[model samples]
Target: MKVLITGAAGFIGHALIKQLSATAEHVVGIDNINDYYDVELKHARLRDLEGIGNFTFIRADLVDAEVLNQIFATHRFDCVINLAAQAGVRYSLDNPKAYVQSNVVGFLNILEACRNFAVPKLLYASSSSVYGLSKDVPFSTRQSVDCPISLYAATKKANELMAHTYSHLYGIQTIGLRFFTVYGPWGRPDMAMFKFTKAILEGKPIDVYNHGQLSRDFTYIDDIISGVMRLLEKDGLEANSVFNIGHGSPVSLMDFIRAVESATGMTANCNYLPMQPGDVEQTWADTQGLFDAVGYTPSVKVAEGAARFVEWYRAYYKI
Candidate 1:
């Protein structure tokens, strides 16, 4: 199968390219390589795929409709895994237009291109943050996600809706994977795991959000890639479906910090603080839909995942 992956320089995107390129799939990846975090890290992710098989990298943005159409016209893709978007929940509070341009407008472009190109499968990235402020223990797709606290979450929910519209109108097979806090090696720097690891090693204080009371279903990156690959290969799923991809178990913020400490062999200087706006108290993903569909079971525990991430960080930075 020929697959086109947006945000190819991103955390999960890079991992997916690595995984799929190892198989029989021909992979094409594109990224705007924005300065949302560190562009160097994004470049580093691309550098990791230098000698991979049948993997082509294109530096581009999803917001550009003309370029997208040209690419689609040039290469007929069997499937498109749309991961390009203005990520970061808190960042959305400051620059909501980024979400609008990248998430909403950009996603529309993807849907249109897929429809025009007759692409069969369209899998996209959603977020557990869509279940904002809900008191639900484990966030499920069956539950209503009409309420989203941040613009980022709203855009993600909108992506799900947009994909559904495309599916209903054009008969495209669309699946939205609402990912929880995904953490592992080659993870995003803005995420908790990376930030905590960096700060701990630098002997700097880490901000314990919600006074260390918040919890998250920290799914490992390998588990995430596995679930995605399984879904990509399977058939018989509804034309438009959504699934939660995460570790079923939730870990407290403090516990996560301790795991990083154990991994780095250094104690963190903790600074407890109130929860920031657009932040949820806790998030737990009910991946039963994924498991029932593809036997997608998360294998890595938080402690082990944290340790692996720390090891990668040390090696990457020579710290």
Candidate 2:
């Protein structure tokens, strides 16, 4: 099958493309490669995919309708996976426009292209942050995600709404994967795992947000890819559906830090701080719905996942 995956250079996008390219007849990946973190890291990911024969990479922004439309016209992809977006909850507090432009307008463009091109399936990345300040223990797709604390979360919730509209109006099978705290090798530097690892290795203090009270369903990248692959290959899914793709087990901030320390063989100098704006106290996903549909569940525990990430970090940085 011919597949188009946006946000090709992103942590999840890059990893997804690597696995998808192995079986897909043709895989086209596109990324704006914005300087959200390190451009070199994004470039490094693209360089790693260079040996893949069936993979093609493009540097483009989702907001550029002309370029995106032309791409759809040329490729006429069998499936379109929209993973591109402005990430980070704290970043959104200061730069709300980035969230709207990339998450809202960009997604709208993607939906339009799918509608015009008659693409059968469009699976896009949503976020657990959409759950916001809800008292729900394990965030489920069935709960109301009406109250979003961050602009980023708000945008993601908006994406789901827009997707439902398109699915109803155009008969496109739109699947929104509400990703939990995804981490592992080639993970985004903005995330907690990467930041903690870097600081611990550098002998710098790591910021323990919410006074070390946060917890997350830190799903490994491999498990996330497996879930996405299942959704891609599975048949008879609802035309408009959303699933919480997560590990279903939440790891506390202190426990996560301990995992990092165990992996790196170094103690993390944690600087306790109050919760930052647009941050949540915890995130735990109820992945039963995803398992019922895809027969998949995230298996990597934080300890194992953190070890793998540290190994990669040490090897990649030669430290």
Candidate 3:
């Protein structure tokens, strides 16, 4: 099947492309390659995909409707996975416009293109942050996520609403996967796992936000991709569906730090700090909706995932 995957240079996007390539599926990937984090890392991800199976990469921004329209017309994809967005909670606090431009405008362009082009299905990225300050232990797709604490979370919620409207009106099969804290090799540098690992390696102090009192449902990259592939294969189920793609287990911040320390064989210098704005205390996903649809279950633990990431970091940086 022909597929169009946005944010090709991103962590999840890159991993998804690699998985899709192995199946000999023709994938046309696009990314603006903005300097949200490390541009070199993004380039490296693209370099890795070069000449891999039937994968094709296009350096373009999703906000540009003309470019997106042209690509949609050219590719005529069976599935369009819109993973492109400005992804960060704290970053959205300082730079709110960036979130609107990328997450809001970019996603609207995708929905419009899909509606006009008659694409069969759309698999877009949502976040567990949409749950906001909910007192719920494990977040379910059925829960009301109207009270978003951050602009980032608000935009993700908007994406869900937009996708649902299109699905209802135009008969497009839209699946919004509310991803929990996804971490593994090729993970984002801003994420806690990557930041802690880097700080430990550099002998710098790792900032423990909320005084290390937080818990996260850290799902492995392999499990995320597996669930995505299953959903892609089984498209056109419900008109509009939302699923929580996460490991049901929520790991504590201190335990997660200990796991990192064990993986790198170096202790992190913990510097406790107050919780930053737009940050939540905990996040745990109830992935029963995903399991019912795709029989998805996470297999990787934080310890093993951290070790694998450390190995990759050491090799990639020649440490």
TM-score of each: 0.99, 0.99, 0.99
List model 1 lDDT by residue over 1-319, tens digit each. Answer: 8999999999999999999997746899999999999999999999999999699998988999999999998889999999999999999999999999999999999999999999999999999989999997788899999999999999999999999999999999999999999999999999999999999999999999889989999999999999999999999999999999999999988888999999999999999999899999999999899999999988999889988999899899988
Relative to the true structure, how large is the alpha-carbon lDDT of every model? 0.94, 0.95, 0.94
Q: For every candidate structure, what is the RMSD over all alpha carbons to the true structure, in angstroms?
A: 0.7, 0.6, 0.8
Best by lDDT: 2
Q: Give the clashing residue pairs of candidate 3, or none.
A: none
TM-score of 2: 0.99
- Once model 3 is optimally superposed onto the true structure by TM-score, how far is the C-alpha of residue 120 displaced, in angstroms? 1.0
User: For model 3, where is the 10-residue window of minimal lDDT?
Assistant: 18-27
Give lDDT tens digits, candidate 3, residues 1-319: 8999999999999999999887746899999999999999999999988888698899899899999999999989989999999999999988999999999999999999998899989999999999999988799899899999999999999999999999999999999989999999999999988999999999999999999999999999999999999999984479899999999999999999999999999988999999999899999999888898989989999999999999999988899
Candidate 3 off by > 4 Å: none
Clash counts for the predictions, in order: 0, 0, 0
